[model samples]
Target: MLTRLAISGYRSLRDVRIVLGPLNVVTGANGSGKSSLYRALKLLADIAQGRIIQSLAAEGGLQSTLWAGPESFSRAMKTGRQSVQGTVRKSPVSLKLGFGGTDYGYAIDLGLPLPDSTSKFSSDPAIKSENLWTGEMMGRSNVFATRSGPGVRIRDDSGAWRLAYEHLSTFDSMMTHCSDPHDAVELLRLREQMRDWRFYDHLRTDRDAPARKPQVGTYTPVLAGDGADFGAAVQTIREIGASDEMDEAVADAFPGARIEVTSQGGMFELEMTQHGLLRPLKASELSDGTLRYLLLVAALLSPRPPALMVLNEPETSLHPDLLAPLARLIAQAAKRSQIVVVSHAAALVSALDAEPDSRQIFLEKRLGETVVLDGVPPSWTWPTR
Candidate 1:
C-alpha cells in the first residue's frame, strides 16, 4: 500500500504531500484542487507507462501544467505584509511526482528541455532525474537505481554501481527502459504494481453508451475503463468472484433487485429484475444513475482487484439516498484493495469517514497552492536533478 504521495510544481499542487490509508476519501470545494490531485496521480501512472512526456504535451506542454506562482514566498508575503510577486531565479524549474510504500519508493523529476532548433520535438520536456529506492523514504543511501538525463545506473549485487543505460531517451521512463527482474528487482516490481493501478473517471451512461449495448462475453476479471464490458465483468463476478456480495450490493441499493446477464449469440446483455416490474430492465432501459451504480458495483467487486483503485466523483449522478449504499459498497471493496475516492458528496464523505482505517483528506487553496487541511502531511523527498 502507498504510504505517501508527493507532487511539486504541478498546477496548484506546488509542493503537496498526502498520507494515504487503506481507504482514502479526498473531498474539497470547487477550485480547491481536488481534480488536480487526481490528475497528478494519473500523470504518475502515465510516467510508469513511458507516456509522461506525451501526456504533458497533450495537456498543453510543461509550461501550461507547471505552477504559475513564484518560486518561494517570504513570511511577509504570506502574512500579507507584502504582496505576492515573482523573484529572480533561485532553484531550477522542475515538476516532480512520487509515491512511497512500506517496502519501496520512486520519484521522477521533469524540466524544460534544452533549446534544440535542429530537432522538431525540441518543445518536449526532458526527464531530468528519477530514483528508485528501498524503504518508505527516498535518500541517497537507499537509492538502488538512479536516472540522470539519458543515462541510468543501478547497483550491482557486489554493491558496486554499474551503468544500466547510457543513452536512454528522455521521453521514456527507466521503469520501462531499464527494469529487469534480476538486474533491477525493485524497479520491475514497482513498474508492475504501477501498471496494475486502475482509475475510473466519469463512466458514460448516455443513451448510446457502450455499456448499454451488448458485447461479446468472455471471462473478464477486470472491468474496462469505459465500462463497455460491464456485463461480462458483473457476470464474471457472479461466476468466479463474490456472487453473494454482488447480490447483496444490488439488493442493498435497490430493494428486491437482482441482476442477471443474458447471452444471445455469444453477446452478453445485462438485465435487472426488480419488484413490481413485469419484465426485467435491460441495461439500455435503466436510468443513468442506476446504470452508473451498477457499473460502480462491477468495478468495486472486481475479482482481480488492482494494487490501487481511484474513483473520481463517483456520486456525480447518484441520488442522495444511494450514497449510503454506495459508501457501504466502497467500504466492502476497501477490504480487498487500497481505494481512493475523490468526491464532493457530503453524505458519501460522512459515510466513508465512519469506516475504520479510512482517512479523509480535505484540500483547500492557499496562495494558489493546494494544501491539506484535515490530516498530517507525510514526509517526502524528491530526486534532485
Candidate 2:
C-alpha cells in the first residue's frame, strides 16, 4: 500500500504531500484543487506505462500544467504588503510526482526539453530524473536505481552502482526502459504494482453507453475503466468472487433488488429484478443512477483487486439516500484494496468516516496553492538530477 504521495510544480499542487491509509477520503470545496490531486496520481500511474509525456500533452503541454505562481510567497506577500508577481526563477522548470509504500518507492522528475529548432517535438517534456528506493522514504543511501537524463544506473548485488542504460529516450521512463527482474528486482516490482493501480472517473451511463449494450461473455476478474463489460464483471464476481456480499450490496442499495446476468448467443446482459416489477429491468432500461451504482458494485467487488483504486466524484448523480449504502460498499472494498475516494458529498464523507482505519484529507487553497488543512503533510524528498 502506498503510504505517502508527493507532487510539486503541478497546477495548484505547487508542493503537496499526502499521507495515505487503507481507505482515504479526499474532500474539498470547488476550486480547492481536489481534481488536481486526482490527476496528479493519474500522471504518476502514466509514468510506469511510458505515457507520462502523452498524458501531459493531452493536458495542454507542460507549460500549461505547471503552477502559475511565484516560486515562493514571502511573509510580506502574504500580508499584501508586496504585490503578487513573478520573480526570477531560481531553479529549472520541474514537475515531480512520487509515491512510497512499505516495500518500495518511486519518483519521476519532468522538465522542459532543450531548445531544438530542427525537432518538431521540441515542446515535449523531458524525463530529467527518476529514482527508485527501498522502504517507506526515499534517500540517497536507500536508492537502488537512478535515472539522470538519458542515462540509467542500478546498484549491483554487491551494493556497487553500475550503468544499466547508457542512453534512453527523453520520453521513456526507466520503469519501462531498464526494469529487469534480475538486475533491478525492486524496480520491476514497483513498476508492476503501479501498472495495477486502477482509476475510475465519471463512467458514462447515457442512453447509448457501452454498459447498456450486451458484451461477449468472458470470465472477467477486473472491471474495465469504461465499464463496458459490466455484465461479465458482475457475473464473474457472482461466480468466483463474493457473491453473498454482492447480493447484499444490491439489496442494501435497492431494497428487494437482485441482479442477474443473462446470456444470449454468447453475449451477456445485466438485469435487475425488483419487488412489484412485472419484469426485470435490463441495463439499457435502468436509470443513470441505478446503472452507475451497479457499475460501482461490479468495480468494488472485483475478484482481482488492484494495489490501489481511485474513484473520482463517485457520488455524482447518486441520490442522497444511496450515499450511505455506497459508503458501506466502499468500506468493504477497502478490506481488499487501498481506496482513495475524491468526493464532495457530505453524507458520503460522513458515512465513510465511520470506517475503521479510514482517513480524511481536507484540501483548501491558500494563495492559489493547494494545501492540507486537517493536519501536517507527510515528509518527502525528491531525487536530484
Candidate 3:
C-alpha cells in the first residue's frame, strides 16, 4: 500500500504530501484540485510502466500542466504585467512525484530538455532523477536504486552502490529497464508492485458500452479496466473466487434479487432474477442502475485483486439510491487490496465511512491548490518527512 505521496510543481499540487490509508476517499468541489491530484497519481503509475513521457504529452505537456499561478502569492503583489515582479533567478522546470509504501518507496523527477531547433522532440520532457528505496519511507540511507539522468546505480548486498550494465533513455524509466529479480530484488519487487496497481476511472457505461452487451464467456480473474468482460468476470468470481459473497452482495442491494450468468454455447450473458419479476432480466433489459451495479460487483469481487485499485468519480451516472450498495462493494474490495476513491457524493462517502477504517480526505481549494482535511475518526494527516 502507498502510505504517502509527495508532489511538487504539478498542477495545483504545488508542494504537497498526502498520507494515505488502506481505503482512502478524496473529495472536493469542482476546481478544488481533486482531479489534479488524481492525475498526479496516474502520472506516477505511468512512470513504472515506462510511459511517463507519453502521459505528460497527453496532458498537453508540462508547460500547461504546471501551476498557472505565481510560485508564491504575496499581499503586496500586483496583477499588472510591468508592475508584477519577474523571476530573479532561473530555476529548472521540474515536476516530481513520489510515493512511500510498506515494502518499497519510489520517486521520479521530470524536467524539460535543453532548447534546440534540430529535433522536433527537443521540447519533450526528460527524466532527471528517480529513486527506489526500502521500507515505507524514502531517505538517503534506505536508497536501493538511484538514477541521475542517463546513468543508473543500484545497491549491492554488501551495502555498496554499483553501476548498472547499460544506460537507459531519458524518457525511459530505469525501473522498467534494469529491473531483474535475480540481480535486484528490491527493484524487481517495486516494479512488479507498481505494475499491479490497477485503475478504474469513469468506466464507459454508456448505451454503447461493452458491459451493456452480451460477451463471450471466459474464466477471468481480473476485470478489464473498461468492464468490457463484466459478465465473464462476475461468472468467474462465482465459480472460483466467491459465490456466497456475490449472492450476499446482490441480496444486500436488491432484497430477494439474485445475480447469475448464463452461457449458451460459448457466449456468456448476465441474468438478474428479482423477486418481483417472474423471469430473470437479461443484461439488455436491466436498468442503467442494475447494469452499473453488476459492473461494480464484478470489479470489486475480482478473483485476482491487484496491489492497489483506484476508482475516480464512481458515483457518476448512478442514482443516489445505489450509493449505499456501491459503498458496500467498495468496502468489501478493500479487504483484499488497498483502494483509493476520488468521490464527491455525500451518500457514497457516508456509506463508506461506516466501514471500520475507511479514511476520508476532504479537499478544498486554497490559493488554487488542494488541501486535504478530515472531520471524522481515524484522522488523516500529511507526512512530516
Candidate 4:
C-alpha cells in the first residue's frame, strides 16, 4: 500500500505531501484543489504507461499545467503589505510527482526542454530525473535505480552502479523503458504495480451512455474505466463467488433490491429487481442515479482488484440516503485494495471518516496554492534535476 504521495509545481499543488492509509478520503471545498489531486494521481499512472508527456500535452502542455502562483510568498505578501509577485530565479522550472509505498518508492522530475530552435516540439517538457528506491522513504542509500537526463544507471547485486541505458528519451519514462527483467527487477515490479493503479472518474448515465447498451459478453474480472462492461463485470462477481456481497451491496442501498445480468446473442445486459416494482428495470430504463449507483457497485465489487483504486466524486448525483451505503461499499473494497476517494459530499465524508484505518485529508487554498490542513507532510526527497 502507498504510505505517502508527494507532488510539487503541479496545478494548485505547488508543494503538497499527503500521508496515506488503507482507505483515504480527500475532501475540500470548491476550487480547493480536489480535482487537481485526482489529476496528479492520473499523471503518475500515465508515467508507468509511457504517456506522461502526451497526458501533459493533452492538458495544454507543461507550462500551462504548472503552478500559476508565485514561487514563494514573501513575509510582506503574507502580511498583505505587498501584492504577490513573481520572484527571481532560485531553481529550474520543475513539476515533480512521486509516491512512497511499503515495498518501494518512485519519484520523477520534469522540467522545460532545453532551447532547440530546430525542434518543433521545443515547448514540451523533458524528464530531468527519475528515481526508484526501497522502502517507504527515499534516501541516497536506498535508491536502486536512477535516471539523469538521457542516461539511467541501476545498482548491481554487489551494490555497484551499472549503466542500464545511455541514451533514454527525455519524453519517455524510465518506468516503461528501463524496467529490465534481469538488471532492473525492482523497476519492473514497480512498473507493474503502477500500471495496475486503477482510476475512475464521473461515470456517465445519460440517455446514450455506453453502460446502457449491451456489449459482447466475456469473462470480465475487472470493470472498465468507462463502465462499458457493466453487465459482464457484475456477472463476473456472481460467478466468482462474490454474489452474496454484490446482493448485500444492492440491498443495503436500495432495500430488498437485487441485480441480475442477462445475456442475449452473446451480449450481456444489466437489470435491477427492486421491491414494489412491477418488473425488473433494465439498465436503459434505470434513472441516472440508479444506473450510476449500479456502476459503482460493479466497479467496487470487482473480482480482481488493483493495487490502488481511486474514485473521484462518486457521490455525484447520488441521493442523500445512498451516500452511507456507498461509503460502506467503499470501506469493504478497501479491505482488498488501497482506496482513495475524492469527494466533497459531507455525508459520504463523514461516514467514511468513521471507518477503521481511514485517513481524511482536507485541502484548502492558501495564496492560490493547495495545502493540506489535516496532517504533517510525509518525509520525501526529490531527485536532483
Q: Least accurate stretch of 10 residues (summed lDDT) in model 1?
A: 374-383
Candidate 1 residue lDDT tens string, 202-289 = 9889999999999999999999989999999999999999999999999999999999999999999999999999999999999999
lDDT of 1: 0.92
The lDDT of model 4 is: 0.93
Question: Whole-model Cα lDDT per candidate?
Answer: 0.92, 0.93, 0.81, 0.93
Whole-model lDDT, candidate 3? 0.81
Q: Sorted by lDDT, highest first, which candidate order results?
A: 2, 4, 1, 3
Candidate 3 accuracy as TM-score: 0.92
Candidate 2 lDDT, 267-317, residue by residue in tens: 999999999999999999999999999999999999999989999999999
lDDT for model 2? 0.93
RMSD, one per candidate, in order: 1.0, 0.9, 3.6, 0.8
- Looking at candidate 2, the ten consecutive residues that score lowest on lDDT are 373-382
Worst 10 residues of 4 by lDDT: 374-383
lDDT of candidate 4 over 1-385, digit per residue (tens) = 9999999999999999999999999999999999999999999999999999999999999999999988888999988999999998699999999999999999999999899899998889999999999988888799999999999999988999988899998898989998989889899999999999999999989899999999898999988988899999999999984789999999999999999999999999998999999999999999988888889999998889899999999998998989999999999999999999999999999999999988999999988989999667887888787
| Ten-residue stretch with the least lDDT total in model 3 | 376-385
Q: Cα miss at 278, model 4 (Å)?
A: 1.7
Against the hidden reference, what TM-scores do the models get?
Answer: 0.98, 0.98, 0.92, 0.99
**Which stretches of candidate 4 lie above 4 Å from their native place?**
none
lDDT of 1 at 45: 88
